[model samples]
Target: MLESVLLAGGGSAGHVNPLLAVADELRRRRPDVRVVVLGTAAGLEAELVPAHGYRLVTVPRVPLPRRPTLDWFRLPGRLRAAVRVAGQAIDRSGAQVVVGFGGYVATPAYLAARRRGIPVVIHEQNARPGLANRLGARWARAVAVTFPGTPLPGAQVTGLPLRPQVAELVAARHRDAGRARTEAAALLGLDPTLPTVLVTGGSLGALSLNTAVAGVAADLLAAGAQILHLTGAGKADAVRAAVAAVTRDARPGVALRYQVREYLAEMHQALAVADLVLARSGAGIVSELAALGLPAVYVPLPIGNGEQRLNAGPVVQAGGGVLVADADLTPQWLRSHVIPLLADPDRLAAMGAAARTVGVTDGAARVADLVEGLA
Candidate 1:
């Protein structure tokens, strides 16, 4: 069997989803291939990987504390344990190649593969590479990037690999525009007569985005626009409470149409129905927006990493969306930016059209080709 190992960990859907996408693509190209994923027991991978039909190998790994603390003492032990687990997994799987999608758990897997003389590849999804991927790059046979300008040598810009549902949505738009819109709306429970705005962070959701959208819920409702909000599990209750307060204070007889969920299992439904999107500009999110022909109001996280900001630039420049600094985000600014587009159907349509022009639909195939060639 052609064996490959994918190294990804942590509960963040952002990291896990991309690894899953690449795995799916790899399977499509080579059905007989044996793919094993290495992650931690504490991560979402425990649930997500097996649900996607892959064998998951878990290790005991903990993240380094942000500040100097007693946890620092455990770092060395954890690293050694992780490395041992990875070595065992690699040997058991007999992997020919190891692909890391960048997380704390990826380090050990990469190192194990290197020790065993197996070829290693690193895929960096952010414009600014994460620390794990940066460290892994030294041993990587090749590095894959999602954005236009990443500075690693032998790095191929393969773009982000979207889920199959997203790819189908893009294809449908090209083949039959009206049918695509109608079908998307139906799938999302959206009223065909009303304009829709999609609000989300990554798969987990952004607190600031949720707060700002909550503050402006009244205005959006007054204008007869609908909302699809994905509040991360941790903050869903708070966001729902805020929305309730907004609805309670709204004018009587006006229906505030919205659907709020802790996670979006059917992302295609949200993307299909969205005329405008309010979100943070992660590289993966930007790629999906571009692929689906959805316009967005991008608020780059103000963490000073510059990754989100870099990801949003192309879409803003393409006239598909406006970039608002996180510090500049307020209910007033959101209302101003979103209200006009909702009121003007032509402007929304134009933005969506422009956004679609920026997507690389064949990203998965390209990355898969790279991985397959390594074998």
Candidate 2:
């Protein structure tokens, strides 16, 4: 087993969530190993890394320049400085091995570990490789990926690392779905018997999803399916306005069926009770939906090399979800496709049953095992 290790990844929940999942697994399996996180003070890791009981070492944030400019000219010096800082952190922690999840922190950590001749492992959470992990894969001792056809050299498909709470909920959902859903409903203050549809577009919310789904709020609620719409922070006003407009001059109690939340900290409960999800197809969210057996309507973000669409492909192909284009998401689409799907209990259940086939719950442990061996 590794005596001491350095974990490098961060900037967003996509990177840090998996890093923390693997960290939790390692500590659970072997309590003696010392773990340290390398990240930036501004990244999400600033709070999560220490909260998880690991020493955190921070460095300056250096994003790889995409366009040629003065910033591009200064890239080499900035990266060299970051690598030096990362090397110091590695030495100070006495880390026997370094594990990097794809993020700004990854490249520097990988280069520093290589300099010290330390074992380095890379984890890619998406089907399409990010620049950091794509480069790191070449020299990594081992590479783990969450999806197949990731195009990483020597890649092992280990699936996304579900957080412990999420993993347990997923396991419970698989074992006793009825009870799990009931408990989750109670936790989220939802009607245990009501079929609920969950809508979320990540932390900041997706305007397209929020607008389209809210446009059909009255229709969905009238169909006897309660809607739990998490309209990420700062965007709740827009969703509420949309729903209000839709429900204007409508029958009494029409709005009662729709619940709009700005953000949900207890997402596990939301996952537990959801019969379907209407959201973005980010790799992490897709993995969660698949692991929890929640059917989804995936709207790929209209940016970034069409990666989100690719992330949802396998699950959609497996009949676990539906993939809709960003612009095509509208009131008509929701009424035509979403309403009927919710109304069909047989189809919903069938999709839910198939979800587990597209995702795995053992990713944290699997990645831990891979990194442990390297250590």
* Highest TM-score model number: 2
Q: Pairing residues by index, what is the TM-score of model 1? A: 0.90
Candidate 1 local lDDT, 1-375, one digit each (tens): 455655555556667877888889889878878899998787888898999999999987756455789889988898889989999998998788888887778888887888989888888888888777777888789789888777666788898888778888888878986777788788766786678888888666788898888888888887889888888778788877877877875666444486778888887877877788988998878999988778899999888568899888877889888899877888999878788779998998899889877778888888777787788
State the lDDT at 320 in candidate 1.
87
Each candidate structure's TM-score, on Cα atoms with residue i matched to residue i, is 0.90, 0.97
How many clashes in candidate 1? Answer: 0
Off-target runs (Cα >4 Å) in candidate 2 are 245-254
Please give the lDDT score for candidate 1.
0.81
lDDT of each: 0.81, 0.89
The list of candidate 1 runs beyond 4 A from truth reads 1-10, 62-72, 234-253
Question: Could you give candidate 2's per-residue lDDT for residues 100-212 as a string of tens digits?
Answer: 99788888999999999999989998888888988888899899998888899999989999987899898797689889989888777688788899999888999889888
Worst 10 residues of 2 by lDDT: 248-257
After superposing all C-alphas onto the true structure, candidate 2 shows an RMSD in angstroms of 1.3
User: At residue 13, what lDDT does model 2 achieve?
Assistant: 95
